[model samples]
Target: MADIAHTVHVALGDRAYDILIGDSLLDDAGAILAERFPGRRYGIITDDNVARAQLPRLLKSLDAAGLGHTEIVLPAGEATKSWAYLGQAVEGILAARLERGDLVIALGGGVIGDLAGFAAAIARRGMDFVQMPTSLLAQVDSSVGGKTGINSPHGKNLIGAFHQPRLVLADLSTLDTLDARQFASGYAEVVKYGLIDDEDFFFWLEEHQAEIFAGGPARGEAIARCCAHKARVVIEDEKELGVRALLNLGHTFGHALEKDTGYSDRLLHGEGVAIGMVLAHGFSARLGLAPSQDSGRIAQHLKKSGLPTTLADIPGKLGSTETLMAAIAQDKKVSRGALTFILTRGIGQAFIEKNVDGAAVAEFLNEMRALPLSP
Candidate 1:
């Protein structure tokens, strides 16, 4: 384990927790788990993909801690976030005779985290769960917030609860197993913090793209910074009431894109978010809320990072402005017949605008389709 130590504190009164980031964190899981959860038994929920590559290390750590545990492996991907699977996970916990005081260990990417956390939230009316996020996207975003739940046909994360984890173990070393596409996808969210309220971080990422992409100390620092920003927001608003809404910068448009694409493997969540952020910037520019150059710069950086910055890049996906508009209408952020969008004036400056004109947003999407692919 490297001597790199980074911790972000999420202040939510009694519900608060720390997000710990470092290399070989999986190796230190024993100590971290023991410190956070002094219980005897734990239920580990992971997917087959993660189990094959990373579960052994986590299991070894649990054994070292002398913590009794049972592992349940589910199928990999978005499809696993269904009611049936969630029920099965709860049953697994019951079968293992887990108590409310015992911990449920989520040891995978967002899918596993969401399903396992949701299971923990409802099982026995809420049991403790630890987030051992292995994916880059999960490490910086999903793992910190206690936003746990499964998805329904209506929308992604529709059936969920705000069940914060007891502790978040972000092992940066797990990212080594990520493929190029997955790595680039996770970088999309990393870029989001800059788009929201850290212009300096945005420029820093632009300048250090090479090192960050190459996986070094610079990348670790960037991931920790992003996680810290998210933790602060989550702490302020445990639910999506006020400041927390800002964290969904690219998520509104990104979620629509994901649903329109049928949530298939063709489009990963991070890839959709990458394109959505560009669209959001463009929409902000169209409304005269943000500088057009900023949108262009963001698109350029996403391209440089090997993430898609254009709608067309997502093959067989919805291209019609009308379809996109319909999906946007179904967005969870919409309230009382009005649409709210998280727009930015510049990097590091974002605000929400309510009662946005849907027609104008449609026009912006149309224009984006006509424009040449951003480089």
Candidate 2:
């Protein structure tokens, strides 16, 4: 086995798995899979971007181990996480003749992970799958949790299932190919773990943001810590019933913005979350629940990391407040037509608030829309 830098075990009893974070995990994947899943065939699901950049390393490893597998490469982007692509992934698995015991490997960023995992979940009445997350965002967040799904016309991730992976291999080397914007986008999620409840981690990030960005020791450490934190949450609330909602601290606003942007290159997922997190903090402050300065601090950190921290940072015209409110209403966090949000008391102090007034949210959004665009 190549030296693994970090390993976080997700303890879910029968559904338990480990998230392995290190370099060359993809190169060793075939040997790893052969030992763990002997006599099982494999279907590899990935995106065109990942396939071009990293698939050969994986295929070479698999071939060396004499493992049998088929590859399905989809178009790369948020829009690829749709019903049409979901169908393509599922049909590809079926056409590959991968049986129930065979595993589906989600070998890309968040979009491929969700699409392939969802495909594995229903392909043969729930076949097991592995997460081979290539992007920094996927390595830290989406690849750890069992929540896998495609986007809906109604909202983001509205149609999906909580199908845990058999294992997660987060190869650090894969991130080397990412552009500055993509890497910065992923960093937004890294900041989120600290924002959720680890004030110390956030402070540490502030101290070492440059090191992390420059791909030093802090980068691996940050990814491992985020994975470990998420593993604990998934173990505690596998289906997002309670504390798991805290993970969506900025996602409500983020998803709405994504829908508004039509899930295109106009705004990346991490970019939306960066802006959403600021909005979440700003909204909390508006309610007199948190210190106003906290939002500004977060915005400063995100902006330094090359992320957009305000609505004005988004290019082009935004939807009306009513349009945004409509998207928020369709959020999965809603309960019986009542709004629910993850609000904060301050840095590292977040809590879920149910039965939030829609009018209050609408009013805050109206005020936000009136602010001058960020220069």
Candidate 3:
């Protein structure tokens, strides 16, 4: 594989890091990990699926670097991001006698990354970890940011902490094994970077959609750009006190939908975000804040990318507006009894509005469900 040189600097006060993007980054992980965590024993946490496909290469790299390492493979999927599995991961790390200075290598998609990273954060009152993101979703979004957590019965990612990784190695080659649905789901987040701040990148993605979906060099570039955008936001606001909220443009709505539907495999995180982004845009349009055409275009783009873009794509039956409204009311974004929504005026522009009326939002969501699918 040819090396593609690209670097994005994440400036987080004194604890900053750089996101390196290339084709054979996994092959270079030994050097990168060694540089950040010299002489530290490492423990790898991964899922069964990823362990089967990518662990051998990672193990070989770790072996070459002469790092003492052990691995714990958990079940794949969102289900694994639970208290039990989190406990199991911590046990595995402890069983390996990993200390505070030792590193935890998260070698799967978001689930493994979140689970392992959170354990690292709490294991010894904060230990270092590295992200070896295999899925596009992890590469573009989760891996770059230090936000790590497990899920609660109430919501996804409800039980986590802000734990930054010592290094993030996003090997594009791993994406080749991702199924089409998973690939498309991850692309929703790639589009999000452009939707929130960089309009040009969004248009660039529109132009190169085919190549991106086909997993060419353009796909790696897109992933890098998205990660860069996220890294910039996280570095500036590591605790999400301000600017980082923009990154959750669709997450509020997406999370609500996920909770209402019971967080099943039927609704992947990115797919929910795809539909949520459209709905958010539509809500902005309904409030006379954005053009309806822009909302339609966003929805159309997601559909073209093979992602769900409407309420219909959500698995469960469309319950009453009251149910959806209740979910929104409990969202973490809400503050002081007001529902704060992330609304977009257009592509590359998004703002958080706390003055939004719950009644009005409920009515709008009800109306959205009534609309017919695009022809």
Best by TM-score: 2
Clashing pairs for predicted structure model 2, backbone only: none
lDDT over C-alpha atoms for residue 86 of model 2:
94
Best by lDDT: 2
lDDT of 2 by residue, 192-272 (tens): 999999999999999999999988888999999999999988889998889999999899999999999999888999999
Candidate 1 — which pairs collide? Answer: 197-348, 198-348
Candidate 2 deviant stretches above 4 angstroms: none
Clash count (model 3, backbone only): 1
Q: How high is the lDDT of residue 37 in model 1?
A: 67
Residues 1-375, candidate 1: write the lDDT tens digits: 434478888888888887888888888888677876676589999999999999999889879888899999999999999998998899999999999889999999989999999999999999988899999899988888888888778788888998999888888889999998988998999999988999999999999899988887898899989988898888778888888888888888898889888888778999989988988888888888888898788988999889888887877646577877888888789989898988888788988888789988887778777765554
What TM-scores do the predictions have? 0.97, 0.99, 0.96
Cα shift from native, residue 149, model 2 (Å): 0.8
Give residue 344's error in model 1 in angstroms.
Answer: 1.3
lDDT of 3 by residue, 1-375 (tens): 325467777877666777777877878787677776779898999999999999998888878888889999999998899999999999898888899889999999988899999989988788888888999899999988798998887677878899888778788889999999998988999999899989999999999999998878788788878877888788778888888989888888898888777777878999989988988888888888888898888888889999988887776586677877887777777779988888888899898787789888888888878876544
Deviation (Å) of 347 in candidate 1: 1.3
